[model samples]
Target: MKLSAFADVCLRTLMLLGSRPDQLITTREIAEQIGVPYNHVAKAVLELRNRQAIEVTRGRYGGSQISARGLQLAVGTLMRDLDVRDDVVDCVSETGVACPLIAQCTLRGALRRAREAFYAELDLLRIEDLTGPASRRLLPFPVLR
Candidate 1:
């Protein structure tokens, strides 16, 4: 189960925000820090805001901040929002009329199990869990300003 680039961005953003719960981060800074396009960061931030995972503040000191619910929502929302097919066979398109062995293939089952395991691991973690001590140390400073 491959996660989308947007999901990666969202998670990274959330982790950064969660690490420093006291500070708001600008989209530009986030983009710079993550080495991603500014538009991509802005889009992800909007998506997260829509999902209520983050709040957007607009003003002289406006920026993005993570909410408690956002931390909780981030755990499984990305995987849930991802476009994943349950049938591995359906995901493959070939000249042949699909693999006949697909119905009996353990590969599909294994893939499903692996996907479930991946989500299960994600479910066990929260945004706060991903933040390191370094992030905590950085939290006190108003870096976004």
Candidate 2:
């Protein structure tokens, strides 16, 4: 199943924050480091703040940092919460038409299970896991893991 761009941004933001737990990062800095737009990072920051996954401070010299809750949060749980996209299969036809077999198609159910399984696999790891040496390398900045 494809994740929404919003979800992708949230994950990326989380990864960056997790990488440098001691530093408070601004949206612009996060955008620059993650190679995403400032607006996008701002939006992600707002949502993450709302979710209490990260703490935000507003003012000059204000920024955000990962919350204690964030580090222990399961990756799959966060993904599931942030991944509020449509079903994996809309079972629809081209030209904005709905498929006729939607009523009885088992394919939709199967695909749903597949998506759940994917999240289940992700449940094995937490945000802390993503801040390891390898993942730290993925970040644009140097980090001590």
Evaluated with TM-score, which candidate comes out highest? 2
Off by over 4 Å in 2: 93-96, 141-145
Clash pairs, model 1 backbone: 53-70
Q: After superposition, how far is residue 141 of candidate 2 from its true place, in Å?
A: 9.0
Question: Candidate 1 lDDT, tens digit per residue, 10-49?
Answer: 7777877887677888998778876677888899899889
| Candidate 2 lDDT for residue 52 | 87
Error of 1 at 128 (Å): 1.0
Highest lDDT: give the candidate number: 2
Model 2: colliding residue pairs: none
Q: What TM-score would every model get versus the actual structure?
A: 0.77, 0.89
Tens digits of per-residue lDDT for model 2 on 1-145? 6667777788889989999998989999998898878888899999999988899988998899999888888988888988765678656677888998888889888888899899999999998899877998877843211
